[model samples]
Target chain A: MSEEIKEILEGLPFWEHLEKEERELLERESRKVFYPAGASVYSGARECLGEIFIQKGILRTYLLSDEGKEVSMYRLRQGDACVLTASCILPAITFDVEIEAQTDVEALLIPVGTLSKITKKNVYAENFVYKEAAKRFSDVVEALQQIMFLSLTQRVAAFLLDESAKNHSQLISVTHEELARQIGSAREAVSRILKQMAKKGYITLTRGEVKLENKEEMYKLLN
Target chain B: MSEEIKEILEGLPFWEHLEKEERELLERESRKVFYPAGASVYSGARECLGEIFIQKGILRTYLLSDEGKEVSMYRLRQGDACVLTASCILPAITFDVEIEAQTDVEALLIPVGTLSKITKKNVYAENFVYKEAAKRFSDVVEALQQIMFLSLTQRVAAFLLDESAKNHSQLISVTHEELARQIGSAREAVSRILKQMAKKGYITLTRGEVKLENKEEMYKLLN
Candidate 1:
């Protein structure tokens, strides 16, 4: 298990830069964890969960409302790290959020204690965590700007473009419900918007796929 | 000038916790900066402005759209410190945000070099920046959730409650335009909603003040 963990850690971007002592501490202390699809990974008001380094699958961070509405904040892909759960050492987190496994996830968690000690001792580790946390902060700011300042149509266009670019395919395979979940909207609302876009010949929506028919025009919509 | 700065530094929450060395470095390097209302303090694609510790007035952080729309992200008030401007050390900031002075602002600016040196040598200073940055992250997440998940009515109600509590008064002094700016809405929309709330007896809208008549009922609307 330790050997496997070592291999996994070595695959991470931050691992190579970690000093010898820091690497030793993590090799001794890091634990592999798993979450099935749709599992609630982190909820607010819990014990510190330290930092998570994803080895497989997607981990989503979002906020839930009293009415059961979920607004997606950002996602962690394989090789990504999240410092949000390490709230024990970060007392400035004043709000609660829900994190879930969008797909079955395998991750290595550095416990708060170990992570704390390493950050205290290593400036690079501290900078790494601070940078990771700031990335999420930037994502949240962008999401807020989109929702509050832009139209839902623009958001839909940007989402489709983002998906297409991310997957490196003109034909994006995603259901209306899934897109709605990612964009924080009603499924019906997303479908209606897509249908209108399809009518306008910007995209072709067939079943669960959105094929970009006018990619340039769609890209122009974002700017 | 040095004595006045020392007096001002003694008033901050983080100043007391800073060690003698950290305090000396800051006192020697920090400078008082002022901005008039409507001044743009930080924009993306610039040199690191270091972190600003507010001495007086309000500094607003927001995102601007090409269509001239402005969405407020968060605000920093008196006695607060912001680590976000020190992007020289935080390369993980991937998005650009505009920071403006909402009021004629006076603040203590810690140059990026001094901040970098202090955090590298002082664990407490590092943690202090981490905590302050996390507070802004938490605020951004909350703002995103509010914009994407909740209704405008609930947001207006909650805003009134927050202002009332912040000012420790039943009556809140703010214009519709100012309220719209804070809530990331339009003046017409805010006025329309305020009129409806006034008609419902939840609030009384004077020219520049919102008197919370049924404060309990307004508070319950948030949940």
Candidate 2:
């Protein structure tokens, strides 16, 4: 069990920098959690969830407004940890976002107290958390810029192009409603924009997928 | 000179957490910079500025669209540090926002290399950076929520109330153009909204300012 825990820790990018004692403490204290796809992993305020380190699959972190509008913040991929959970150092800071499993996820859950203790004593762990937080901050800023500055059509085109590239395929397996939620727009608006894109020969939309036809046009729209 | 540096360092909230050697290095290496009101402090891409610790006054960090529209991200006041400048930990992560002196500002600048070195070696320093980054991340997320989920009128009303409260005056000393820039809206649109509010006896708009008349109605609009 100890060796297995060590192996799991070693798989993380920053684990090699951890001290032996720190690794041992983490192995002994942290709990492993598994969530199937579409499962609501964590929600409510930041205090509810402890420090989460994704070992496999993906988590979608988002915010839902009082009026039921949802804005997708960012995705937590494998080896990504929730830096916001380490809020002990940040006073009354609150993370009012929800985390859901986008795919079957295997994650390590460390209690906030344990993580805070380690962060206080271990430079390597603190650096890892700091870097993760910084990266997430940049991501949030980029998402905000897209939502505020870009037109709905431009956003949809850019999303299609980026998703296609990310999946290494011209066909993106996503729905217009999903796209709307991702870009923080209405479903009808997203569907209308996508239909227009199809009319322009930029993309071909089916029931739940969109196939890219003119990558150049889509890139132009993105610009 | 060394005593003066120590005194300056001690003025910071995180100063006592730093080790003696870290404090000495910061005293020897960090440079103090001052910017008058409305001065462009940091702009362009992420490469220009290093880690910044604001000692006095206010710095407004904002994002500008291709069409020249601006959205205020957050403000860094006294004892606040720029977490974006700690991007040395995450390679290729860029912060594209522009920083301007909202008021006459005094700040401490540390080279990227020095910050990176100390962050890697000192847990206390890393904790300071992590907390700052986490706080900024929360701020960005909140800003994104406002941009994506709230109505423009609601945002404007909320902004007025918040600003009034912050200044301890019902009279907000700002132009409609400045308000539009802060909320990422057109100047004409903001002016129209303010006019409508004034017609409804919610506010009284002057040449370059607005005075709140009905706080209850403004709060109602915020809801």
Candidate 3:
């Protein structure tokens, strides 16, 4: 594999221990694709779904409820794989969720058929992919715990803290409605809470963005 | 390879396609252990916990809150595998939850070390373990979705429905307090709701039990 490709695989838990030849084979199989912000990668009724890896930028996985409410399942940042990894292994039907580029994004799109063929022929490939799935599953479990135990305000606070850790930014660039969808609440409820938090100097809200004014205070409120 | 062991493997997703020889080898490695009702398998303070598959009887997983409130995480009935598989692999300094047998139980306990060795030596074992983890993760995600989307009454109704499906019984052999713990609500609140439900002819409550009087009505109320 090229040095450039090797570096990318190094950070990925599954590919870290791959042999040079095996790494090269996988690199050969993978192809890069890009989508602009707000562009839909795949919708519920679309075909041509496959394994997608976030090479750069952010994306959100969401489903439309029967009532036309948007339910945000998760957000995938740079270097993270899509939440629907298992869907790639068993491609029997179209998925309900739509994968949209939250920002101008680049991804490695590996065809499901090609992936299955590689895994069948290579034990290393199968182990790597399954292990990656296991990690994703663990992450999903943690997300579940949060949704069950945390309130709407707490969930948003947790999200802010998580994003701050990732981007080191006090400011979070998301609208109240988007944040409400992520936390599984009404936009009015979110707006009301944000106003309260801002009044107490816990956060600063202006237009569509929010900035953490007192991290310690916000942390206390969350806990 | 014995036919008896091969038959048992067919019941589990992990060992589905194994050759007779491989099945026998796995059976040889597995050890059946027994625990009486109320026996603790592993406390939240323990480490290096292995996988426990309930061959018979039941087990309960729970965590105690700071205020000494015990929250029931899950109940593992006969044939249910311990869902906290990743904790063993990741090796936490202390266990995250306590597992206690709720009845005289027979279990197949697979040591983490032995499983690790098997995974390194055999492709089937590795795939099986990862697949099981993936399934458990999915269950956890579903639980999270329920917690986020369902109301308190809906959750209780859904829990009853889920229990009925599992046991084929309208009578769930658990207390209102226990139900509250699982649902993360107060015991008094659960009791009040049960009384209201009973008055509405949706359910019947007695000492240490709650029975569905009208499942269709309960389902309607849940919706």
Candidate 4:
């Protein structure tokens, strides 16, 4: 198991930066973790979950409001390393969010003790953390800008277009509830907007799926 | 000038992490900059403005949309160290923001080359970057939440109350335009809301100031 962890660690970008001894030490200490699809991966505040390096599948990170609105922050895909999940290690990260596996997953969790020692002693390891946090910082700002500047319909339109591009199909297999959860809107509100879009010939809504109709009109809504 | 720079550098939290030679090198390389109230501090994309440490006054970091809507991200107060400003060094911070001096400001700008060297060689210096980025990441999340869940009225009420507390008085001496800008609302929208608040006797809006008329009522609006 430890040898497998070492091989996985070597495949990561930070692998080249790790000193030989520290690399071996981290491989020995790090543990592999798995979460079934739709399972809660991390939640609550300041519970050092350790840094997670996603090897397979995706993790959706979102914030829950007092009224239970779920605002998706961003997703961590394969090969992504997350520092925000291990907020306990970094004292300044005071807030917490929910992370769930979007699919059956495989990942390595670098335990807190091992990572702490490396960050304390290894500038390269610490530099990796800074780089990851900096990357996510800009992403959060983009999310903030979207929420502040775009209308709900605009956001819905943009999300649909983005999904269509990624899936290489106009048909999006998402229910109203899932769409609401992903975009931080009420399900009823999402339904109402979808109906309006359907009436406008921008999309065709079927049970559990939405298909883009007039792609240009839907794209126009994004602006 | 370099001697003065050394004295100021000694007062910062990251000063002790520097080696003796790095300290002298940084002090000589660093420059002091000042901005008058409400001047744009940083703008554009992928430009390394260098790392800035605030010595006096405040900076408001904000995003501008295509239609010219300005959304305030967060503020950088005295003693704050910023990494997002120097996005060129950290490739992950791709989003650009307009930073404005909220007041008369004095700050230290560590040139990108010098900072790059220290962060490259010193774990502690790199640790400071990670910590600062994490702090701001949580703050950006909070700002996003406020925009997501809070209504325009609730946001206005909360902003007025926060400003009152900060100024240590019930009267917040800011114009409607300034209030709108601070909380990322339209000036006319802020006026309408303030009018509604005034009608409810929750607050009194005068020529260029807002006085908390009924503090309890104003606080209730936050919820």
Docking class of 4: medium
Better of 1 and 2 by lDDT: 1
Better of 1 and 4 by lDDT: 4
Model 4 CA deviation exceeding 4 Å by range: A2-4, A12-21, A167-170, A192-204, A212-223, B2-4, B12-21, B45-47, B117-123, B199-202, B213-217
Per-model clash counts, in order, read: 0, 0, 0, 0
Maximum-DockQ candidate: 4
Model 4: per-residue Cα lDDT over B25-72, one tens digit each: 887789998999978788855366878889898888888888888988
Fold similarity of candidate 3's chain A to the true chain A, as a TM-score: 0.82
The candidate with the higher DockQ, 3 or 4, is 4
Winner on DockQ between 1 and 3 is 1
- Per-candidate DockQ values are 0.56, 0.59, 0.30, 0.67
Assess every candidate by TM-score. Answer: 0.85, 0.88, 0.81, 0.88
Error of 2 at B34 (Å): 2.5
For residues A149-194, could you state the per-residue lDDT of candidate 1 as single tens digits? 6678889999988878866899987899988988788899989999
Candidate 3 per-residue C-alpha lDDT over A1-223 given as tens digits, one digit per residue, 9 for 90 to 100: 4454446655565565556676666678667778999898877555546677787898887656445666566678877776363364632212355678888998777666666766666666665666665565555544555655667778888888887777789988889987888766788998998888899998898888899889998889666
The local distance difference test score of model 4 is 0.82
Query: Predictions ranked by lDDT, top down?
Result: 4, 1, 2, 3
**Best candidate per lDDT, number?**
4
Runs with alpha carbons beyond 4 Å of true place in candidate 2: A2-5, A11-21, A85-93, A111-113, B1-5, B13-22, B29-31, B85-93, B111-117
**Better by DockQ, candidate 2 or 1:** 2
Q: Write the per-residue lDDT of candidate 2 for residues A1-223, one digit (tens) a residue.
A: 4464566667665577778887777878888889999898876654455678788887887888888788988888876787655555545356667778887998888777777777677666766666676677777887888887888888898788878876689998788888888878889998999899899998898989899999998888877
